[model samples]
Target: MIRIPTLRHVATRSLRCAARGAVQQRRWAQVHDVRFLTTQPSQAILEKYREKLSKKASQEGHGSIDDLKAAYSEKIQEQRKKDSTEGTPVSQPNAPSSFPPSKPAPKKASSSGEKPAIKPLGDILDLEKVAELPEKELTAIWRLRHASSPQTLCAVIPAPAYQAMESLARSNPYFVLPVPHESQGAEMHFMQWTFDPASKTSTVLFTQLAEYKARGEFAQPHTTVTHHLDLIKDKGLVLMQGQVMEGRNVQPDHAKWLVMCLQRFYGGWEQKGDELDGQRKERAEERQKLLEWFTNGDPRFSVEKLLEEAERMG
Candidate 1:
């Protein structure tokens, strides 16, 4: 025979169930609030794996883990030194606390993403006694901050002017020398360059492949050419003489294209051949466009104007 349960017993059982549900809900909310949960490999999990890997490495007699830790330590020390020198606040990377006590990241100085302030040409020219500055600094000061096209295509600029162009070009993502363009498809390859301010000369080393191969990304330059230029002050022309130091791997077709570019852009020579072919005509048209862009177009290299505006604003 079944007996009826007491009302007190039923009420007590319901209360206990509610309490367990509340506890579970609170635990789930805490997990949801953790920021690392949304990103790949939660920080806690990463640390756990890292510790396991370190232990394994130690046992295997490979110091990979120790080396990585040492490198990170050195980086932290360098950062601290820099901060101290610059009078900025420093934070230790290996602090006991893994994460910062909930704080928002600092806002950037400019929200609009505007370009940096420009100084006037006059102010730069009239600077007090001048001493030799590093090549990088000189490049920065003399940089062509505004140019119409990626390819400057200027005819014989002075050493200083060309260097300024190179400064800007180096910063560009697509800065490949011997850049072929015409009726045929483009063949793009990387280029590395070095400059000597005293001698007013530059050397360009062109790579063979557009992208990395099995051998490596950078093999010795397929073609190495040193450019010696004479500055014609009155005409504002740069007369370039190229000496091909190395071209063992350069194909015949590629060499022809390279010479054409060197003559048209650097040497300030018009494209000429026994036969006036389509390629020659195309190059001539390109040259004309560049000339028009430089002469009629703004060309936008007035440092004085920019600096004056900056000072006026101040």
Candidate 2:
């Protein structure tokens, strides 16, 4: 029994020594592997790996989660302070509740037919109020409102009247001018039609006849003959009454009416002259026919006649 106990004690001591030796050998092998597996890793490699792990932790909302929560709390507190300073109500998020709630997806619009909206110029300009303004004010208003066509006479009148005048002015370019002295007391205001080189059209500007009389200039009635003669000499044609002025046999009534229309159409800026050519000569002939129509009320010499003449000229 004494031999047996001694042998067991020796065996236990040997086993413990072997186990310790094996553990030390394994640890030595692990250290060796780390030092020179293939090539020794540099200090930079270890540092890079550590940095990558830190970045991954941060992106996964683990490393900086506390920091982010603190930042958000600070932001909310700052917003509350701003709202308090501005005297505005600050909306707060509600705390999570146990009650169940239903959510619905947004609905799309129907693809069925739908008309677009329309807006008119009259609706754009309050015509009654505009008409009440003086000419200078009216011009300024037009300049402010429609800068593209600022000098146009349509700026001063009512919507319907302006439309009519615009329609008339489109076909003829007349200039706005004070009526000759001869028609100073006449009910109709007159403007001298002149050619505009820039626009290649005649234009006119008109206001109330009383407005001109109020200016207290040209107290005597002035003949339109000198005006027409000057226009013919300079521009070769006077655009008037929706007709080009050219040739002989221009009647006084027609001339007077043309001047009146011009005044009604323009605000008083004179235009340049038309380029004289064969086409102008034909236009002149047609103008003579319009004059004949104006004087005699002859249907034969009307616009249709002028159109026919234009066609023949073509």
Candidate 3:
């Protein structure tokens, strides 16, 4: 019984071996028998192969990698061909025209031996509006005129005085006092009020005889008083007084009295040779040289001489 069982086991093992050998032989036959192309494939053959791959993929219900790649390449080529053929010019936004025709140059002034016509003094004065400015502004305008020169109060007066004058001219049209000629011998003098005005202002401008002469060239001296008053009224009486005091580096009290003496001599009967009432009148006349020296910008006019002269007069 044991011999029979062993023989049966051997038979079963042999059958299993035979089945394995058959599978191995079939696999080797398949690998060896299948043929591959020996020559380089043509483009047409590759295309046909691609088509077959696509058909096979479609039948199997999925897209192949080669099929998708071929489709993408064809789309790109179509886009490039369309772009090359169309060649559209890009539209640009409108820009402003460069260098538009320039305006023609103005015609030159006629040289027909005709001088520019001068406007009348009345027209130049602008009097209707001139009358409206306050007295302080008028004083300022007069001060502005004399204060313009370097030899006069220009050296003594602060920069603000010049600025104030400029500001006054800009604000009030009447405050415009244009120096007519460069060579016009304009002289300016400052004076204080002895008998104060009803307005209680301490200072006034006293135009010298020289200024009077220039006044005759343009208009009467007294007629220009409106213009003068327009200057003072705008710049303010106290402001002028403060400037005089600051410029001279003197006490306001002394400067005030000195200015009064000036006003007395310039405004009073000194023009007529008639004497003023008090000893102050005589003293002011005696001090005329010093006053002229001060106005003339003479650096040599010593404080010693001024004090000595003051002592003699006193």
Best of the candidates, lDDT: 1
lDDT of 1 by residue, 1-314 (tens): 11212322332333354456554322111111111111222244336568786877787776876564454554443332222122112223442232222222232223435221111122222222112333343233322221232221112245554543354334421123222222222233444454544444454545543222212221344444334342323333332322222334445445434544433433233322334579655554544344233233334412222222212212
The total number of steric clashes, by the backbone 3 Å criterion, in model 3 comes to 23
From the highest TM-score down, the ranking of the candidates is 1, 3, 2
Steric collisions counted per model: 5, 20, 23
Q: Which stretches of candidate 2 lie over 4 Å from their true place?
A: 1-141, 146-275, 306-314
- lDDT of each structure? 0.34, 0.31, 0.30
Best by TM-score: 1
lDDT score, candidate 2: 0.31
lDDT (10s digit) by residue, model 3, range 181-247: 1122111222211111322222223222223223311111211111112223343322232222223
**Pairs that clash in candidate 1:** 119-307, 120-307, 121-303, 121-304, 156-238
Order by lDDT, highest first: 1, 2, 3
Compute each candidate's TM-score over C-alphas: 0.28, 0.18, 0.19
Worst 10 residues of 2 by lDDT: 28-37
